[model samples]
Target: MAEHAHTHTSTPSPVPDLNRNRLPTLFEVLSRRTLPPVDLFSFYIYMRDQQRSVDYLDFWLDVAQHMSLCRHYVRELRRSVLVGTPEPEKDSKRSSAILQGLGEMSHHAGPSMYATEKERDQDAQMSAFLREDRPGAHDSPQSSNGPRNRPSPGISSSRDITSDSNSPAHTVARQDIRASAEKILYTFLLPGAEREITLPGSITQDVTTAIEEFGRDDPEVFDVAKDYVFQAMERDAFPGFLRMKALGNLIPATLIMRLILGLVSMFGGFWAAFILIFLNETRQTRLWLILPFTIGVYSLASYQYSLDPILALLGFSEYTPFNFSRVREPYVRKLLAQRAIMVLAVTILIDAALCVLFILVPGKRL
Candidate 1:
């Protein structure tokens, strides 16, 4: 026998390069431009605050609209560094810069970081100092040193960004506002309440005022306001279940009544058997057929009554004559035998216990 020649070939597995530069491509940003400016801006701000580069912000923004449409899109974006089709490397930086500029412009109209009362007081003092120092204050539109002034469109006294408050765009913005308001209300206001207390009426008043400030473009503001009112009513109206648990006085009377009725039925079953067995021959034959019918009717009635207590109470009188008859069909006989065994077992157990107790006790009386 010729010795077999053995040959081994080892194929090299591909090693992923960890050092490769993986930045967001320009195509990702351009794709996200299909989303509404507000949603795009919001997503951009989130990415920026997280220290993600402008390229990643663009990629997330492009995928934002698709987020509502497909759940998989979010997972896919998070899994991959570059989502969507990648553009040429040269154009990526320019695309990122444009998106960043748009995001900055959209955020410009929002309240300043120093809009609080303390900040406002400091601003007032600074303005007074500037006025006194400069004597003739040249507050020019081009002056960068003066208070940062937003250009007025002169549309209305409220200085709202949009003219038509009821537009779809405005409704979307109002939703954002309502979400912010809810966060503030729940986080800051609705904590550490001991008992059911009505919400301060001023919270509702403040919400109403906030809605008005947003103007008619967003009816959702009013909807959110109404929701807060309803929530306040709910908090005030319902007592906590934990409070009622301590009382322990309110036993479900209906359940107790059902238990009594069940005990009564057990006694009735024995009486029904005795009456049917001891009756005259003609009546016995008649009752023998009627007993199964009665049992069938009572079982059905009992099943229905189990669901509703009022019906059970009203129909209790009619159920008294129901009796169990000899079931002939094999399937039915098996069911009846099972039920009879259960009843007999319970009865025997109780009787045996009583007999044992009686035997244990010293009795003089015969």
Candidate 2:
């Protein structure tokens, strides 16, 4: 039992929120990631739809994927190194191009290797189909039973060329690492990429220099750039993500109930204040109106007091904006929330004043 438990136990996923295993608190998302995170899809939606600055998340995930690929290649390289299997050499006489990875060994026979000029021409024609140039009507269609139709090469053979190559393990590993790093740099670090991260000039420069210097087969080539992007998202983007999830998690049944209650708490005072100030009817109505408005006032006040933290969490300053980064969607949302609460305050106060007037100096009964 102990051995089984030990063997099965693994590190917790960095993306539990994405996996839908558990939801972390706001503090965990913000504070915890600094030490490092998100529910992947939800956070992406929040950044994309609400924050309007999804490049932060996009760049982060891109680097994460690059890192994962790098690690995978590294593991495969290590295993191959341990096994010490000398890779096989290709037969030069075989056909050069392949539509798919595998077929009858005869299909691979080169046109040059055939016995006769007529057969060589035939082999060349068939080789076109094998070269994946599209398999349809041709000058020489195969005999009815012959292999005019080739089956799909299964997934496992996708890497057969690489697996059978004469190149040493290090050469393949180097190419994989170099290709991944260049792609990351092009997609994110380049000056005008479609989805660039826009790091500080120094940070981006450092990444370029590091990749140039020691990136060959180095899995951590992008670590520095990754850290900067992670910090940017952690400090600025993640809070809004947490709020989005919190609000989104409320089911329709629960949401409707909460909205009903929140609306009462939000606007009940204003509704009563309208009744008192504009449609004053009687003493009893005035007195009764006062109590609800008073409660509304309290609720709005409390919300207002707590609102600063919530706004801060929404990247209010950045969007408003602290960095003067292009102002965008979530700022509008934050502003709307603040204004709605202010309106509630105004209405509640008006009703409270009317109530005070009625109590302190009784108006004539109407």
Candidate 3:
């Protein structure tokens, strides 16, 4: 029997080199573009001051760079997962390596770091100052000046880059992040201006304004609009005309129903009043007529006032018009109530005139 031989070949990974000479220059550009590190508790003024000096092109470039770093990191992770080891090594070196890679990825997306008791006082003092100053010194994933994550990963691939750049979902997300950054940047740029930005109902605009204006000359109102803006963007898609058709039908249907009820009540009230006046000698006829007319009036008034208590008490709707078909709001019912009242009033007047005419003209009831 012949001895068998096997040849094994390993392919080199395509992860970008972090130690490239240009990387330091990139960090320098990033430092110039980004707002300088300041105490989160007292960062408003400092943020405004530092951000004003940012070069627009540099700012966008830095954003692009951050996006690229995240994209490359994800690609490397995907590759590693695809090339996973089939058998576990007892020493578990590969497991440790994978964990280290994951840690590096997390660091880029981590919240702004605060000093800890374990850190040397000097290191803590120098951390913010030296972050982008030393360039390659902090370029490592484990370093203090390591790159940060953007809202999305940047990739040159038509699919990834195109989706990030142009797809509605991704585009809106990037726009939100960009808009947040811009809000802070612009606020700092024009510190003396009084600008009012609309915020969502969740955040109190007055409180936000008060906090920002505590020490500043001009009260800069920072709206917690992100929750509002993103929520508006992410809301279940508009549902279009199909969803609206039912709602649209409601207004017209409401108006029509009210008009119908009003006409019926109006004519009924007129006839009953005529009959009661014609037969005034009978007490039972007068009592029966009054009870139903009062009920009909009450029912109509209640329907109008159900949505608008103020209007109900006032006995008229300010937001709605008298014409049934012209009303666009849910206030169609209110218009109907108004119409009912007018019809009842007119019927009473007519009945009074008919009684007077019969008495004066002679033999009118015949």
Question: Which one is best on TM-score?
Answer: 2
Candidate 2: tens digits of C-alpha lDDT, residues 1-366:
222221111122232223232345433332112110132333444466567777765555555444333333333323333344312321122322221122221211111233455544443333232223212212222222211111122212111111111112232232443455566677778789776777899888877765555333233445566667777776887766644333222212333444455459537655755555555456666667666656555444434332322333343322111221211233333443555456456756765675676544544323
Instruction: Assess candidate 2 and give its TM-score to the true structure.
Output: 0.42
The lDDT of model 3 is 0.30
Candidate 1 RMSD computed on C-alpha atoms after optimal superposition onto the true structure:
25.3
TM-score order, best first, reads: 2, 3, 1
Model 3 Cα lDDT, one tens digit per residue, 1-366 = 012211222122122333332211122212221111111111111112322212222223233333333333233333334455212321145533433343212111111221343222222222222222222321222222222322221221112211112212111121232233333334422334233333443354343343233311110122223223323322321222112111121222344455566557656765776665565434444445444454444334434422222333233322112311122122323443454455456545654554444333322242
Worst 10 residues of 2 by lDDT: 144-153
lDDT of the candidates, in the order given: 0.28, 0.41, 0.30
Runs in model 1 lying further than 4 Å from the true structure: 1-200, 213-271, 277-366
Question: Model 1, range 1-366, lDDT digits (tens) per residue?
Answer: 013221222112222222323221122112221111111222233233322333322222212211111112111212221333222331244333332222111111111122255533433332222223221222212211211111132212221211111112111221232233333333333434221123466754564354334322112222333344334322432122111111111113333454556455545544554444454324333333333333333333333223222222222111011211121223222333344444445544544443343333333322
Q: Which scores greater on TM-score, model 1 or model 3?
A: 3
The TM-score that candidate 3 achieves is 0.22
Off by over 4 Å in 3: 1-252, 306-366
Q: Candidate 1's error at 356, in angstroms?
A: 18
What is the clash tally of candidate 3?
Answer: 1
